[model samples]
Target: MTSDKTELNDAELSRYSRQILLSDVDYDGQLTLTQSHAVIFGLGGLGSPAALYLASAGVGKLTLVDFDQVDDSNLQRQVIHREANIGQDKVASAKTNLQALNHHIEISTVATKLTEAELADLVAMADVVLDCTDNFESRFALNRQCRRHGVPLVSGAAIRWEGQLTTYDFRQAETPCYQCLYKEEQGQELTCSQNGVLAPVVGMVGSMQAIEAIKVLLTLPTLMGKLMIMDAHTMQFRTLNLPKDPDCKTCRD
Candidate 1:
């Protein structure tokens, strides 16, 4: 990790000059971002923007994991992929786009599905994890791994005209994890492929996920104990408290 007082290179100082001017993210906070390591799960709608912004913001390292490949349907909301990358693995495509955005940071790609042990290892090494996957299974697995590692997770989901964003900071003992809100056994999972989602809805949620990721990395106040809901149809937003469940199997002792 770079020291708070470490001098910034001319390009770095010029590139981040705007954010450095902000009182909240001055030199120290920006330095914190540069020292952070983020692991992003899923490279589709939510992960696309989350990964891009984190890289652009100068996160020191990013490991992108996704087993799927780009398809024509993804281009609408998956801004990181282009027509030329339609058949490429999502992580590979995302890596290309992110690398083009910022060449100073480190970017890694996991094009294959990760086994339980592999996921655990990655989560253990990450300073923060972003759960942008659409399925409940992956979310549950990632949540459990994050809890075990005591790492914070920025989770986002979008389907139809609705979107949801939240953070689970396992480092904070009382904060509720993803399992507290959605039990693993619950059925009737929804997906954009079947439910149909507005393009901008995903973009909105993903953008929020990126913002939450940065906040988590910087030790800033986050939506760790709350859920932010957005309705693209009515153009309305709401937030509600998310209390920790003492019996949560994933987070409880």
Candidate 2:
């Protein structure tokens, strides 16, 4: 028996029957996901898995922004890029994986990195932003754009089995911006190159990142205004309920 609660037709049903079975997405939730646009930055260790799941879960449009190319070292954590795709652009490699996961969604890729101006322009065009970049420069730049545009952001980071996930919604008073947690001068203190992250851990964190992004777009309950950290060694989870810093240059703006 078909219910009027779903937006997917017979084809989509045949493709995502399992998901549709869940009461959460009987029909309307699935349609919301299939109609929203999510912009992901970096497309590396963390962004790779996030983009993959976002596309698979039927996020209407996936915009990938990256300026790097695939490398043999990237295969250790960049699940979306294969050994055979070593020399190709990371954005292109990501698109291939995203399409293979779900051909129904529109995959938009920017093989070039988004400059300050470019990032602002793209943020304006997207409903949500995912800060998956490894470098602080890009992360800060993206965070600034998210603030100026008042866009919801899901930021995730992973390194050597240590990972963090947080959501920012300036629309809500007292929400902490990325700057509140990681000050600018700290820089790329923990990069995959130096810290050496586990491949699966990156996948785990990135997958969660995607889940958070989906929740935000779906207007579903999520870890908004909270910082969640995970450690693989002790298998511990910590929730830090911190208030927005009044001096935060990004959010306080």
Candidate 3:
């Protein structure tokens, strides 16, 4: 199921014709996408759309990680899972749908929370990692791993009517890790179950995460050191610079 093709076959060209039409994602870019691997850590609101787009866009392989099972309450925003999958593991549900979307791509699922060592192994294998996970603990753990492996990380979050998106291209010396933006002590994690969220807000942020991931694989310009904030209520979007923390424990030399 692994893709190591340097040239796109006729079927692939037709399947991704629209994307290949873009000057930036021409034949070469499309081929690059088909040869890339992405690891996603979550299958809820944010991970759902992010996984969908990456699969449809022809990322060669995707590793979905989520220990939670599909719940009735998740239907409102976790679009990749269906009502029939209510009791299924989130990663399993996501794998089924993503494969249905693109059988040409390889999809793997991890139905358990990964230990730091396990997480590091996966991050080291990925061309890009999407931090669709919730909670500061998971975010900080992933940030440290991505920094250690020098893999780009696309992090997104949505709670209530606000959403945030950022990329940490760890391959670059000056890029900031997640800890640089929000200290561990500053994390007062909020959840949709507790605070409630507008469904489309997560969809928007997750979709943007997909875009940034593709850009990373293509070596195109991305929000590497910038954070994008969205207020769905006001329908306004803002991008701010995210500078590196010289004292960042995970990324500081």
**What number of clashing residue pairs does each candidate have, in the order they appear?**
0, 2, 0
Q: Is candidate 1 or candidate 2 better by lDDT?
A: 1
Score every model by TM-score. 0.96, 0.93, 0.97
Q: What are the per-residue Cα lDDT tens digits for candidate 2 across 91-154?
A: 9988987788888888888987557888788898887899899878877888888888888889
lDDT of 1 by residue, 103-170 (tens): 87888888888899999998998999999998998999999999998999999999999999999998
Best by TM-score: 3
Give the root-mean-square deviation of each candidate in angstroms: 1.6, 3.5, 1.4
Q: lDDT per residue, candidate 3, 1-253, as tens digits?
A: 1366879988999999999999999999999999999999999999999999999999999999999999999999999999999999999989988888999999988998788889889888999999998899999998998888889999999999999999999889989889999888884789888999999999999999999999999999999889999999999999999998889877764
Which pairs, if any, clash in model 3? Answer: none
Worst 10 residues of 2 by lDDT: 1-10
Cα error of candidate 3 at position 56, Å: 0.5
By lDDT, the best candidate is: 3
Clashing pairs in 1: none
lDDT score at residue 198, model 2, on the 0-100 scale: 81
Positional deviation of residue 249's Cα in model 1 after best superposition, in angstroms: 1.6
TM-score of 1: 0.96
Off by over 4 Å in 1: 1-6
